[model samples]
Target: MIKLPTVSLAAIGYEKFLWKNITELLKTGMLIIGIYYCRKIYKKLDDLQKKIDKGEQDKYDFQKKFEYSLDKIKATIDKGEQDKYKIKQEKDNIAQEKDNIALEKELNKEIEQLKKEIERKKAQFKSAWREIPLYADWRKEEFQTVKLTLDAATAHPALFLSEEGRIVTWQEPCQELPSSPERFVSIPCVLGQLYVSSGRYFWEVEVQDAHSWDLGVCRNNVARTGRVTMSPQNGFRVIRLYDGEYWGLTSPETSLTLKEKPCRVGVFLDYEAGDVSFYNMTDESHIYTFSKQAFYGGLRPLFRLWSSDSGPLVIVQVEENTTML
Candidate 1:
């Protein structure tokens, strides 16, 4: 309320003065009451706010402690999981080592057995009746040490001759002899030494026809190069007969005659449990072998025939002491 000037001050009567004093007293009383109540309410509110703030701080503290504990528990669990994994890996490594040891032992046994066979063959060298070249010059009987050559047999038919009267030659007049496994087998080498090592080999050939020419492991004759037949009816053939190189591996008890070309042909040895494996000599990556067959090498007068004509067969006397690189 606007403080109206006390109109009683201008009044000349005693009642006016009394009215002015009463108004002033009423205004003073209101001011005192308002101040007292306001102070009391503000204090009460301040106290209530302080209590709420304390409760919130306690909640925040509890939350922080709970979060810290959860983090610690997670870390412990992770560490335990890592420990378990480490233990498992160690166990696996131990098992693998044991397995490797066992495999090595088996390989050693096989090596020893092979050595014994080699020794026996060496002992029988002199007594063995092997076929030497019929030529007058003994040096002519030696088998040529083979090396890779750029010359490839012309893309003509492979001529073959049987021990029987039939003369087989590949050409326009001669119909390609039916590729029979029996016809293309390896003939035994009556003389000379055959050596081979076990390993992977890569075999690569550029041929017009894969079926016409049989390439794989073979035994006996140089003609067939001891190639394995490519069919279950026969077997997989890995022997290669072309320019001049001849290579193959023979297992024990299997007898074979490594004759020169023209006489190159397949011969069946009396190997009851002989095995001859053929591998790619260049890269040493592919392997072909007979599952169950007899293996033999001796001085028997067997010759390998390459072409059907006997003219191409060169009888060379191979020195036993010479080493092949």
Candidate 2:
């Protein structure tokens, strides 16, 4: 066998040292690369943490703003409820005031009506007292004479006429008079033959024993065939006597309280001046007057006797000199 060469110890040592240095250098390069990659990963992690913190802060600010807006809305809703309550209270007060004013007006109207009725009664009483015996004789000098006669054609069937148709008496049994359209059928009444249109006339009627009677002047076209109330609307202006009470025949009948009963009644008429006056002939005092009358046509004397009254209603004959007294 042939031996090649024998290695030296120094050469072997140098080769081992070279191998160790190469190993150390490779380890250092690997450590440097690891450090650079670790630093890059740390920077990325830090940036992600900052973004998370900012998101949390933004969420907190949004919650605070939402709470503030909700509080403002609650306050506005409370104020709106308060305003609605005030509006309802004001409307109720206005309605109550109108009702009170209407009630006051109705009360005033009733009071005024009562005053007028009182005044009318006062005037009636004053005229009635003037017909007393003390003042009766004093009014006799103002009398004027007028001749009057009853119209037989206008007399009721229950009435009997005498003294040239100047006297009328209510008979229980009806007379055998002809039924005429112008005659009074139910009431015991009569009309005068003479009618005065536009002149002053005066006449006297004697009702000494009569209980109830009506004496007046009526228009020529007054109702004569039926039962009629002696009123101004019916063309009859009169003084009525029934049940010991007297009344003036107006649209609404007015009561006339007399102090004394007159045996004879005097009637005076001024047609042009529209005046009809009555007087108590026995006492010669003024009784009542019909004023402000509208005389459209001829006016005739009208007389009515109650059904129960049996006494005669006579037209008294007045001498020209006695009427002037």
Candidate 3:
């Protein structure tokens, strides 16, 4: 502790010298000096220690509060993320529900339409049966012929006789290039009919060697005849015929590598009004035909394969009106 100034009452006792020295100002100075020294010493030691403790406690408290606030803020952010996820999930669920409903409605509509179609077909069948009383006995006649295989180069080629007895000659590739620079000689029929009926026609050829190619009748060269040519590129195609005045029918719509092996393909023609149908000779199921409208003029209703790629062509007339009746 700090030593304070002590002023005694004897100093102010009433002795002549004491009374002379005992002034009011001296007494007040001594008291004020004792109080200031004691307060200064307290502040330097114990009071300063209390102030430090208070400051540390306040800092600790503030830190704890800050940590709690951070936790709350983090919790709020997490809640927002969770809410977003829930909203997306809800939207997805709603979309799925709508899709399911639409699908069900479409299926129901299709089922009803099918039922109506079935009933209509059944009624039409009954009506047709009633109209044709001799339907069961309606038998078609069949015709047989001696298929001819002719050599057009050596012998004057015999013209193919149609069911109508009209001499119909098909243009075919018959002669092979005799010279070293080999080229094929194509024989094509000049067609007269420009219009066709809605009917199916079949033709066949027996190829012993590689040289058989059929030439189709086209209206004009303007109707580009697509052909999958011997060219490895541009596959099977419809080639423009006679300076673009006709069309050349290619067997396969796409061309494949030609093999040395002998193979035969059958050609089928399905004519419908202005439409001329064609299919691959290898498989009749592959229907590929050009529209008559696309032709410059009209389709020449006649065709023949009379050329040779390497050898002679042996064409067999398989279909006749007598046999097809």
Encode model 3's per-residue lDDT on 1-325: one tens digit a residue: 4332334553565334343354555677777898898888987877788888888888888988999999999999999899999998999999998999999999999999999999889768744642342331121122222233332222212233244432334324332423321111222332323232334344444444433333333332222233313211221223222211323444333332222222433333334333333323332222333433422333333334333223333455554543442
Highest TM-score model number: 2
* Residue range 158-205, candidate 1, lDDT tens digits: 433323312222323433544443343243111212222321122122
Q: Rate the local accuracy (lDDT) of all candidates.
A: 0.39, 0.77, 0.42
For residue 129, what is the lDDT in candidate 1?
21
Which scores better on lDDT, 1 or 3? 3
Best by lDDT: 2
For model 1, state the Cα shift of residue 66 in Å.
Answer: 2.6
Q: Which stretches of candidate 3 lie over 4 Å from their true place?
A: 1-39, 42-45, 134-325
lDDT of 2: 0.77
Can you rank all candidates by TM-score, best first?
2, 3, 1
Give lDDT tens digits, candidate 2, residues 1-325.
4332224534556544453565676678778888778777877777777777787778888888888888888878877777666666665555666666777777778778888888888777766766455453444455456668899999888888895888988777787988788888766778998788876677889999787899989998877665777788888889988888888998788887655688999887778778787888766777778867668899999998887554778998876533442
Comparing 1 and 2 by lDDT, which wins? 2
- The runs of at least 3 residues in candidate 2 whose Cα sits more than 4 Å from the true structure, single-residue gaps closed, are 1-144, 321-325
lDDT order of candidates, top first = 2, 3, 1
> Against the true structure, candidate 3 has what lDDT?
0.42
What shift in Å separates residue 287 of candidate 3 from its native position after superposition? Answer: 40
TM-score for predicted model 3 compared with the true structure: 0.29
